[model samples]
Target: MTAILKTEHLSHRYASTWAIRDINIEIAQSGIVGLLGSNGAGKSTTMNIICGVLNQTEGNVFINGIDLRKNPEEAKKQIGFLPQNPPLYTDLTIDEYLTFCAHLRLIEKNKIRSAVEEAKERCSLGHFSTRLIKNLSGGYRQRVGIAQAIIHKPKLVVMDEPTNGLDPNQLIEARKLIRDIAIEHSVLLSSHILSEINLLCKEIIMIESGRMVFSDSMDAFNNYVQSKAILLRMDNPPAKTEIVKVPGVTQVDVLSEKQYRVYFDGSPEEVTDRLITASVEQGWKIKEIGPDKGLLDDVFKQLSSQSPQ
Candidate 1:
C-alpha cells in the first residue's frame, strides 16, 4: 500500500542555520507513529512542513501519493493537524466552533451538520455542544481541538504533543481517544516524553539536533539497546569482586543490601545462567534476577552518538 505520509530529504532553514536537515519519514495507513525527539530536535519543523503549515527549504512532502508542494489543496484534504497548544476560541460554544471548523474544512453545506455531529460524538463533545469552550476544562477544550482536526475524517492526523499538560486522568483519556481515532485514521503523534512514545506508538522515528537518528518498529528500537545489566536480588549477596569473577561479568552496582545491578559484556542469557549457577554453588541465595532494559536516555545517547555528523 502507498504510505499515508512520506517526506523525501525534508529540510528547512532559518536565516543562516538549518532547522532540520535531510529528514525522511514514511507512515503506514492506520496506526500511531511517534515522532520522538528532545526540545529543539527539528520534530516540530518536520511536522509543520508535512502538514503544510511551513514550506521546507529543501524536500518534498507527499500525502497519500499526492505531492503536497505541487498540489497543496488536494493533498491537504487528506491531512488533519493539532498543534501543541490547541487552537480554540474560548468564547465560542463547542457546536459553534466545530461548525466553523467544518466550514473551514470545506465540507458540503448539506453535510456540515452531520459532520459536526460525528466529530462531536467521536471526541465525546456532544454533551458539551452548547457549552462555551472557556467553560469546559482543559481536557474538554483539547477534545474540541481534536474534534476540529478530524471533523472531515482526514486519512492522516498529525498531533504535536497531544497529551502535553494534561493531568494523569486526562492523559489516560487522551491516549484512549487517540487510539480509537487511529482505528480509522493514521496518526502521527509527536512528543518529547520517552514514556509517552513507548506507550502509544507502533513505530518510532527519532531525531536529534536537527538530524534523523533512528526510525524503525518499536520492538526493533527496544532490542536496539542490548541488555547490558541484570538486576539481581539475593538474601546473602557475595562481594562485588566475587560477582565480577563470573565470565562476561564486567562491573557491579550495589543497589541495596539485598539487590545488585550487575553489568556484563557478553550474552545476557549466558551471564545470567552463570550468575545463577555461581549463586547456587556459593550459597548467595538468589531471590530475584532479571535482565535490565537500559534507560531510554541511554538509548538516545547511543543513537545520537551514532547519528551522521
Candidate 2:
C-alpha cells in the first residue's frame, strides 16, 4: 500500500542551532503511528513540517503522494491537524464553530451542514452543538477540536498531545475516541505517554535531539529487548555461581533474596528450560519463570539519555 505520508531528509534549523536533522518517515495507508520523543526532542518541529505549519529548512514532504512544498494547497487537503492547543472560538457555539470550520475547508454550501453534523456525531458532540466552546470542559473542548479536524474527512490526521492534562476518566474517554477516529483516518499521534503509545500505536517512531533513534513495529521493539533476558523467581534460591553455571546463562544478578535476573545468549525458551531443570536438580523450588518485560521504559530512557544536548 502506498504511504499516506512521507518525509525525506527533513530538517529544521533555528538560526545557528538545528532543531531536527536528517529525519525521514513514512506512514502506510492506514493505522495509528506514534511519534515519541522527550521535550525539545524535535517532535513538534517534525509534526509542524508535515502539517505545513512550519516549512522545513531542508528536504521534502509528501502527503498522499503530493509534494507538500510544490503543491501545498492540494497536499494539505489530504491532512487534518489538531495542534497542542485546539484553535477554537470561545464565543461560538459548538455547532457554529464546526460549521465555520467546514466552510474554511471549502466544503460546498449545500454539503456543509451534513459534514458538520457527521463530524459532530463521530466525535460524540451531537448534544453539545448548542453550547459555547468556552463553556465546555477540557475533554469536551478536545472533542470539538477533533470534530473540526475531521469535518473535511482528510486522509491523514495529525494530533499533538491530544490527551495532555486530561483526568483519568477523561483520558479513558479520549483514548476510545481516538481509536474510533483511527478506523477511518490514518493517525499520526505525538505523545510523551509511553503506555498510551504502547496501547494505541501499531508502529512507533522515536526521535531524539532532532534525529531518528528507533522506528519499527511495537512487537519488534518488545522482541528486541525481550530476547536477551529472563525473569526468575524461586522459593529456595541457589548461589549466584551455581545459577550462572546453567547452560546458555551468560550473566546473573540477584534482584532480591529469592528473585534473580538472568541474562542469556541463546534462545530464551531453551535457556529458561535449562535454568529450570538446573534449579530443580539443586532443590531450588521454582515459583515463577517468565520473559523480562517492561523493557520499553528502559529503552526510552537509554535512548533519550544518549541524545546530544
114-168 in candidate 2: lDDT tens per residue?
9999999998999888999999999999999999888999999999999999999
TM-score of each: 0.84, 0.81
How many clashes show up per model? 0, 0
> How big is the positional error of residue 274 in model 2, measured in Å on the Cα after superposition?
9.9
Model 1 ranges with Cα > 4 A deviation = 230-266, 270-294, 307-309
> Across residues 60-161, which tens digit of lDDT does each residue of candidate 1 receive?
999999999999999999999999998899999999999999999999999999999999999998888899999998888889999999999999999999
List lDDT for all candidates, in order.
0.91, 0.90
> Who wins the TM-score comparison?
1
Clashing pairs in 1: none
Residue-pair clashes, model 2? 0
**What's the CA error at residue 248 for candidate 2, in Å?**
12
- Cα RMSD (Å) per model? 3.7, 4.7
